[model samples]
Target chain A: MLRIEHFTKTYRSKVAVDDLTLHIAPGEICGFIGHNGAGKTTTLKACCGILQFDKGAITVNGHSILTDPIACKRDLAYIPDNPDLYEFLTGIQYLNFVADIYEVSKTDRNQRIAHYGNLLGMTEDLTLKISECSHGMKQKIALIAALIHKPRLILMDEPFVGLDPIASHQLKNVMAQHCAEGGAILFSTHVLEVAEKLCHKIAIIKGGKLVASGTMEDVRGQASLEQVFLDLEDTL
Target chain B: MIRTLVSLRFRALFTGLIVQRQKKNKSSKGTVILFAFLFLYVFAVVAGMMGFTFYSLAQPYHMLGLDWLYFSMAGLMGLGFAVLGSVFTTQNQLYDAKDNPLLLSMPIPPRIILLSRMIPLLAMNLLFGGLVIVPATVVYAIFVEFSIVGLLLQLLCLAGIAVLAQAISCLLGWLLHLLLSKLNKSLASVLYLVVFLGIYFYVYSQAGEILTAIVMESQQIASILSKWVWPLYAMGMGCLENGGLLLAFLGICAVCFAAVYAILSATFLRSATMSSVSRKRQKLNLKTSKTAPPVNAIVGKELRKFLGSPVYLTNLGVGLLMAAALTVAGVIFREDLLSAFSMIPGFTDLIPLLICAVLSFLISTMYISAPSVSLEGKNIWILKSLPVSGKDILNAKLLFHCRMTVPLCGICGFVLALAYG
Candidate 1:
């Protein structure tokens, strides 16, 4: 479970996120939708213990992200939109490095890396340097690294941008499987169709404010996700 | 078009300085002022040394009836230093500049881009050349019986030499970039280390003999400069006595600069357009083992980064490498070194302390942490999102520094103690 209360983040004179409150229960896939500079990335980053909010409390599995960041981060993983990884390291080496960071057991790391590497058809390229990888391949490696520890909560920012249709479908399955196994996911995406189909709940943000949030049915209600999103942007 | 690119490069170089100036806080503003004063002090000291060198040489060369030789030697030495300093900066500006892609994508021609990039490097050489040559010129004007035309030619030669130095350095920089590109990344650092060691050995081996000959038989130095080093002779003749030689030297400078610019624009544009990273795929072998703790892993990554970058290692790690090399030399030649020190007046008692002090100074100067954070740039978020304390991340950098430096220092300290005993 993840909870954010009255989250506010300011950059000098500009307020990036303001008075935002959000929560996600176990076994739920919460899709966060917002336009560019709408503070979706900021809020996601704040929850993942990467960004600090000016006035708010964010807790991951009852551990406050601000006060107990390591503990909060232990149960959550974040993959940024453009995953600029260590270009010097080979794909396998980078994955193993991240595994070590999260303290994954040897047996678990081996199994998880093999499974994901094969699933993404990246096993053959595991020895290739990250700098040599295509955009999609790099995205797959980052996704695998994020999932290596099997955190209870996953926060991804535009996780679908570089992914191909096949990889995107595989990722959708993985998200569903992760949620079904009692994990929660809060992902920001511009793809409303993917969110409409895969998300158990949805949150719409406008200018750093949460304009609408509820179960997918309630948020859209007789309107398509795109129609509902456009309506929210127009009014809010 | 060239002006825009030069301004962009200038802005990039002074971004931090500009930011400090924009700050509202008094302390930040004070730092900018402090840096300015520090820069001026360094410039003044360098110029002062140049002036002193010319003043010392003026009387000897005047007596030898070779005032031109003195000017030539001073200009050559000044240009030599400028070339040495400009090589690294030229390499950074032309080959490794992060803005290359953005600049290349624009509608400007490649030669204009090359010229624009070289301008800043040339400006730096000019600063260094002026510092050295201006002082020498003033001294020559005061002491030497130079004609008005001679004095004017001398000043022109000084500026001309700076441009020539920049041209040579840029050529060398372009060559290094090309050579390093063809070699494996791991080998580049090792190759640089070997080259550095080789240069050090050559300088140290030759310095005593060269200095002894120059001090005991100064005329021999002038003969060598005038006969073998034709450009130096031409420059001095042009500057102090002859106007025709000055025009010839200026003509050479212009030709060299144009030739280099043309060559870089033609040959390097293709190489520059391509990505810097090697495209060879690494062989895959997945072997599972128990991973290191987070801090250890971080330290390992940091070490890889430090070792992987030839520029970072060659420039910043030089001190650490020197300490190790010196420590080895101390152990190997302890008896000879001790006897040599004992020969000096009141030196035997302070040998151990002197060794320790030198080692400490070398270790203190290797601050890898200073630029390590900025090097991360876009990838810093990966660290921030990891399941580790901020303290651990900082400690990882600190520990990496300690790991590289402490063991060698400890060994040297032990060896010096044993030698003293």
Candidate 2:
């Protein structure tokens, strides 16, 4: 569902993501594991057409993010780690704004918002101005808005940081349900346990390079995902 | 810690001129100089008006043996100018600052925090006050007397008046904060526009007679000042080497300032942390959900933003207001303007061109689209991540701008055309 081919992004002189390649098929959750400053965000932003890359291409459902951004973006949703959504809008207003952009039918958007908003326990809070919401509430709103259009691919960066344990479990279930419906998710996270338990394929990155990537058993071999991540980090 | 806070506040004020907040590199030397000249130009124009007004008053008051009254008048005008200039800023800095909660959470005392914020405002008051007082002193020296001690005393009195101005502004700003929280912010901006335009038109119409009138009525004005406002009387006298009255005027200013500061300090934390009036809650109903075209949605968003933000509305909407005002003014003075145009050799034939030129000037001031991206600030990601093209977004903003401005211009053009014809 998402293919990042030889993607190299640079900031002035320093390289952010260097000659990296990764692919996530439909019905898969690809956990992109990296430490701080490991170019995880750089790669994620490039894939979502939020950042321009210096080399190579990122494609979503066969549409190039650089050349066919609107088409690529129509098939995917990106929820950044901080959930910096529009504070001037009420939660439902923001959802409707996004829905309007994707041309989501009034009926479909209403049903999806209700379904996701209830699953995240955010139904009562949707009437409040986003500025008045807590960090966790904003995250839930972003999640609901992302799912409102029924995008085929989801690109999330640290999507669980501010969520309560119940919401986090619910989000895990949502991810599983999305993959079960043949939609793929490529998310970056530091929580190895969540990645180990949830991800069908795991890609470990160290210093802008893909250190190991494959099915869970193939990458971890008899060890845990945390050990493999730490071993990769120690070598750097 | 106070020094650090004050420096940060100053940096915040000069961020765009000295260095953009989004950029890491310093502003180019040319950009800095250009900004300096632009600011200086505005300051010079206002100061020049003050200088001229005082110049007109100086010799008349001196000949009438009302030198003390001359100084008192300048002090009063200076106080009014400074208070009006700084009141909105004081309200915003005190009540609406984004970092208030962050700083309030720190270990610093609330009073100290308030002091640091007020110190910059005091500096601004001094600058605004000086725009009037400095020009008055220079005219006074040129036309009346230039005694070294007297000049220094006038300056000292000016400092006291600036403190008084700051106190007045704080009180008024507090009132505005409370009032604005309850009312639509656009109303205050509209009031500001009306007052500004009212003064402008009155002066414009009476350009020849007003200064002469002030000169003619100098005695009555002087008497009113002396009998009703004794502090101003003392301020005037003190400016001319009356050390005792200077001390008295200074004392009154100091007392007023201290009382205001004490009262504000007691409630600084409470007011600073106060959120806007809480809105009544309403749960979302999916049954009532609706959608619009993407372009229309973007324009609706822009409209809401323009209305919600006072700065955005006033600065940009002034053009639309002017266009409306011109249409009304043109209708009212249609016969007079047509006669005036006939007096010009070729102007009658060029009426449409002239009207077009005037309306174009007004419409140019409507900035419905230009600042949209920059105004997004941290929310650029929402647009960047969305399925809409950048071109589509900008086109929507332009469409919104056109909808706001073009119809008004067309109506203005049509009405003036008919009225003139």
Candidate 3:
């Protein structure tokens, strides 16, 4: 579970996220929807201990990201929108490095790497340098690295951007499985249909303010996710 | 188009040097002032050293009627300093620059783009050139009167010599890029360190002997050197006796510069964009890997980073390589080295201690953390999101430095002490 209360972040005098409060329960997949510069990325980054907020607290599994960031981070994994892996390292080497950071055992890492490598069709290319990978391949490697740690919370920013259809389907299944195992996911996406289908809870943000947030059905009511998002944006 | 490219290049280099750091640390007034003072101090010391050397040479040179030797030495020193100062810049700006695609994709002519890059490099060479030529010329002008034509020739030769230096450095950079493409990355870094240190230490250790020799036997040395260095001979003649020699010297420099520019226009795009390494897929073997704590993993990652890039490796690990080289020299030349030190009172017994101190200072200066942190650039999110504290990440970088420095320094210190004993 992740909770952020009264979070405020600013770049100079310009607020990127203003007085934001959010929570994700265990066994829930929360889709954060926002237009460009709407603070979704900022909020996600702060929750993952990547950014320091001006005011408020963020907790990952009851550990404060600001005060006990290491403990908080250990229970969570974050995949950024651009997966800039160490270009010099091979794909397997990068995964191994990540696994090592989380202190995964040899047997566990091997099993997960094999399972994910085959699932993502990256088994043949694990020895290639990350610099040699295409965008989709890099995304797949990043996803695999994020999963290798087996964190209680997973946060992703635009996680579907470079994925192919089969990989996207695979990712959806993985997210479902992770949620079923009581892990929470908070992801930002531009695709409303995917969020509508995949997310148990949805939040819409505009101009650094949350416009609506709740269970997907409660927020959308009779309207399609896209229609509701458009209406909310117009009101914003 | 040339102006735009030049501005872009200037912005890129200076933005890192000035703007970004200041913007991030806007509250630090003391830091800014300290940096300013430090920069000024270094500049003053360098200028003072050059002034003293030129002034000391002026009277003797005038008395010996070896103005040609003086001119030649000045020109050659200027060229040498410029080239030495610019090799790394050439490597970065010409071959492996990150902005190649962004600039190349524009509709600007390729030759214009080449000129844009070359201009800043030329400016840097000229700056270094000025440090030598300006003080030397000023000393000559003040100590010895010259005719109007002589002064004009001298001025023209100075400008021509700077162009010559820039052209030669560019060609050397081109050759380096070619060599880098063919060599193994690790071996290339080792080779660069050895070559650079060899040249540096040789000149540093032998400078006093060379200066004494030049002072005692200027005429014979000048005559012999003049034969091998004709443009310098021409520059001297143009400044003292014959104006036509100055024109000839200028013509030679012009020809060389034009040739370099022509080659750059013709092939620079291909050369600059050429990838230094070729990628080949290795056979995949899925094997279980033992895990370490996060700090160990990060240190291992940092080590791989250091080893992966020849440029980065040489830049950061140069002191370690130098220490090793010094240790071997200490062993092989123990007798000769001590004998040389024996001439100075009370210095012979402290030679080992001195060597250790100097080596320690060099080792301490080789901090990779500051630059490595900046090197993360846009990819910093990886570290930020990792299940590690800020202190752990910093410690990882520090661990890398310790691992590289400690053992090497200890061995060198031991070798020095053992040789002395």
What does candidate 3's lDDT look like per residue over A1-236, in tens digits?
A: 89989999999999999998989999999999999999999999999888988999999888999889889888999988989889878898899999988888888888999998889888877888887788899999999999997999999999999999988999999999999999999999999999999999998999999889999999999999999999988876
**Model 3 ranges with Cα > 4 A deviation:** A132-134, A164-166, B21-37, B146-149, B184-190, B215-228, B309-312, B340-363, B366-379, B391-398
By lDDT, the best candidate is 2
Task: For candidate 3, write residues B1-421 as lDDT tens digits.
Answer: 7787899888876656555552354435676577789977976777677777777777788899888788788888888989988976886788788878877898877788778888898888887887887777777887877566666677777788878988998899888888888876667767867887788778788977877777779988787877887888888777785868888999999999999989987998899788865667776765545577889999999988888867677777777777887889889998897888899999987876788688868777677776888877777889998877778898999898888888888888887878887
Task: Please report, in order, the local distance difference test score of every candidate based on alpha carbons.
Answer: 0.84, 0.89, 0.85
Tens digits of per-residue lDDT, candidate 2, B125-169, equal 999999999999999997888888988998998899999999999
Query: Compared with the true structure, what per-residue lDDT tens digits does model 1 show for residues B57-141?
Result: 7777788777777777778878987887778678778887776788778888878888888888888998877888888888877
Q: Give the Å shift of residue B84 in candidate 1.
A: 1.2
Top model number, DockQ? 2
Candidate 1 residue pairs in clash (backbone atoms < 3 Å): none
Q: Model 3 in CAPRI terms: which quality? A: medium
Pull out the clashing pairs in model 2: none
- Model 3: fnat (fraction of native contacts): 0.86
| Comparison by TM-score, 1 against 2, better one | 2
**Best candidate, TM-score-wise?**
2
**How do the predictions measure up, each by TM-score?**
0.91, 0.95, 0.90
